[model samples]
Target: MTLKSALLAVLFASTAAVAVAQTPLPPADPLDDRSAKRVERMEKVVRELRSIVFQGRDTGKPVVVQPAETDAQIMSLNQRLSDLEQTLTRLNGQNETANFELTKANRAAADQKARADALEQRLVALENAFNDLKTQAAAAPAAGAYPPPPAPPADPAAAFKQAKDLLLGGDYGNAEQAFSTYVTNYPDNARTPEARYWLGETLFVREAYTDAAGAYIGAIRGWPQTTWAPDATLKLARSMVALKKTADACRTLDELTKRYPKAPANVTSRAASTRTAAKCG
Candidate 1:
């Protein structure tokens, strides 16, 4: 039998033992003395023939119980049965307490499992986001990452034309770079003076008057006979005036009017205007 059934059976036997102990024998007859004597015979027969049943959990073996003869024996057996009942009651209470603790433990474990599952889901989402960022980085390059490398066109005329076009288009930064490149790569080319003069133009329009003056001086010294030479000299005077060097600028304009006598009328008029503006002697 199951342990619960076994304990129940033991309890049932204990109850039966109590009932048997409580049974009253037949009462004596008042007119018959022998009938009263037969009461002792009835009691002895009950004591000899009586059997009780008990089973142990370990062995599952039935134990034969003898009936109690004396009052002391009966009382002792009753006390032990009462003690057993109290012990069983206490054991049952402990079992219920254990079952309750076990249920709470199960609930705690389930809650922890749920939290762990949620954390795992979040981790997976983060990993997917990281992978998406990695994919994007692989697909596209960074902005302003690669600059145009150093380039000097093979043909000096084409290069000069490109630099001049850039200057005319008002792209001063690239025009400066392109003209500077042309000057460096083709110093002896016939177009170099024109390129350097345009370089000064790029600087002058940007209001970098000091750099413009230097570029004009380079063109005049390097290609004095070129048509760009007189142009560069006039611009040089203007650049010096922008620098607040009125004396130098006036002397330059004076030299220009004398040295390049056949200079453009516009150059002569600009020189006169600049001389008047500065009150040149």
Candidate 2:
């Protein structure tokens, strides 16, 4: 070979080697379009550089060529791609964590609602049970399950005296109960009217004016001629005054003076006071 031919061949070989060395590698991700396009452009630039070098050699002229991207710039782009991939992975993890927390919060809210519903149901059940107990308690007496009535006295006169003694001893509560039982058991007894009058005295002492008035009327029925009748008539008028029945009280006072003309001095004096209180004419 001639010396000039050998120099051209060496120059062509060196230029082709530089072009091969400067060619960039294919991108790691085949689906990355920008990287793939960059690699394709680099390859095309290398091919064009090789074509220019071969043409220069044929025409006896030197050709200069430069690479599209430096080594540092390529490395920087690869690092940026790796950072972008890592950021995507971190974002995906954060999204998963957020979704998990949201689901857990929803479950907790459902649990709280279920607990509240259970508590409300329990309260309703407890209220219903209390109402049932109240109903049963109210119905006990009607169903005949309550305590029985007390036994009747063996001797009606003896019972009447004992009840009178109780009243004299200041035990008005027991005296009232005893008189009430005596009147109920021996309704047709000779002393029943007097028992009723004493019952009215017991009720009057306790300020049960309406009940005392009723008992006094029961005692004075038919205007019995007993020793207690004059006092009973006076007490009936006083009970009527306490009951706010001024007209009834005046009529009762008039009946007392007409029926018992010689009532005891104390009873007549009390009757006069009661008539004044009642504004009797």
Candidate 3:
């Protein structure tokens, strides 16, 4: 009986303690709350659960996350850098090419100018050579061991004047010399036949029939085809008659008539008249 009453007493004490612990408290007014206690309680519970599951701890600092970069943004930056490098390389290549071409062109142009200058110099040298040759060709021939080329014939009028002057000075010897000189010096002179005729007259005046005949013969021979030929032949015949060369005189007359049949008939009449007047017919 004594042990049973001890156990009943311990049970009645535990029952009374439980009854006090389970008794309800008085309710607070909703408007009187100044904090979100319910939301705070839920956040505290989530933090505890996440730490236990992921971090292996119930109490520690919150986790952190870095922002991720987009693929298009990274690709765009790399492409821009590559394009810039290519542009720089192309510009450098173009500059080198332009410089090389310019140098080659300049050298070619200089070479061409040099060739032109050389050609100009050669032309000048040739021109100088030509001028020198012309100068040498124009120089007169060497000195006087050689006989001088014959002088051009004297003026006919001047020769006749000299002959008349010597005749008027009463210098028959000089007159003969002058007349002879005139004939020799002016073989084809226009006054040559007239000079010869005058020379014959001078010799006749001096009574030199042989010399007169010789001078008259010169007139006949010198102008065989001239207007003076017939007169000269007639005078020659007269001079031959005076020299007592009748056969020669007759032969000359016959020759004149045959050679100049076309001559006027007065040509022979004049020859006959001159011979008769000279008292030699």
Candidate 4:
């Protein structure tokens, strides 16, 4: 054989062997089930490769002769193709590993974001709770501060009724107690001045002139704008007269008439005034 022809034969044999070896082996069938979809897909790919090779052979562009050395050449090419296929498989494995890492990383990132959102929600809740606590504290009264008790309610009607009942019953001690109770219990009651006036009258009837005069003065001070004032003023002068303090009684009676000329107790007041003027003169 010619050297160039032999070389071409070796080249063609090597190329065919390389093509054959470059084809991947079918993946192992799971449980020997060669009828699975993956096995079918591998068969389809093998058929496509054989079809492409048959078409290339049929094209017949150049004449090349087979050489006696073609077997070794074919085997060497197949080994190279197998090496290339192994390299491609390794690259595919690396790609799949990279995709798996990417998926894991994405999931981790989502978890981290979820944790961050949860922490943020907790922080907001804590802030709101703190603000609510601050508001409650601001609304609270100062320490050591207490509200004062309200003033005791007055019973003016009850006080008057009890005083009148006492005076009518003629129990002097109980009557005085009732009037004093009225004064103590209903200091601002409208009947307080009247109670004092009655108290003075009760004392006067008991011949306690000084105490009666004091109570009458109290009545005048407590009920100055009322009709009881002039009556109490006149009674005060009477009380002084009973105590035999003529000059003092005269002065009191004179002042009573001068201060309250149109008093409802005008007759009694004027009469006392006249007696006081005569005695003093």
**Predicted structure with the largest TM-score when compared to the true one:** 2
TM-score of each: 0.45, 0.46, 0.36, 0.40
- lDDT per residue for candidate 4 within 1-281, as digits (tens), equals 97456546655665665566456666773335554565555455555544444444566445333332546799889999999999999999999999999999999999999999999999999999999988877898464242332233356786577667767877665676677777887788767778888888778878888988888887888337776677777778777777788788888777776887787756564665657544865
lDDT of each: 0.78, 0.84, 0.68, 0.72
Q: How would you encode candidate 1's per-residue C-alpha lDDT over 1-281 as one tens digit per residue?
A: 88768666766655665566556655672437785566556555444433222234445666555444676788898999999999999999999999999999999999999999999999999999999988888788663143343465788888888887777776778889999999999999877777778999989988999999988887887437766677788889888888899899998888888789998888788878888876799
Off by over 4 Å in 2: 1-152
Which of candidates 1 and 2 reaches a greater lDDT?
2
Candidate 3 Cα lDDT to native: 0.68
Please provide, for model 3 over 29-131, each residue's C-alpha lDDT reduced to its tens digit, 9 standing for 90 to 100: 3322433464445445444443333432223344342222444677778899899999999999999999999999999999999999999999999999999
When summed lDDT is taken over every stretch of 10 residues in candidate 1, the lowest stretch is 46-55
- Best candidate per lDDT, number? 2
Name the runs in model 1 displaced over 4 angstroms.
Answer: 1-150
Q: Model 2, range 78-193, lDDT digits (tens) per residue?
A: 99999999999999999999999999999999999999999999999999999998899887846533233344468998889888878898878788888999999899998898
> Candidate 2 — what's its lDDT?
0.84
Itemize residue pairs with steric clashes in candidate 3. none
Instruction: Report the alpha-carbon TM-score of model 2 versus the true structure.
Output: 0.46
Q: After superposition, how far is residue 119 of candidate 4 from its true place, in Å?
A: 99
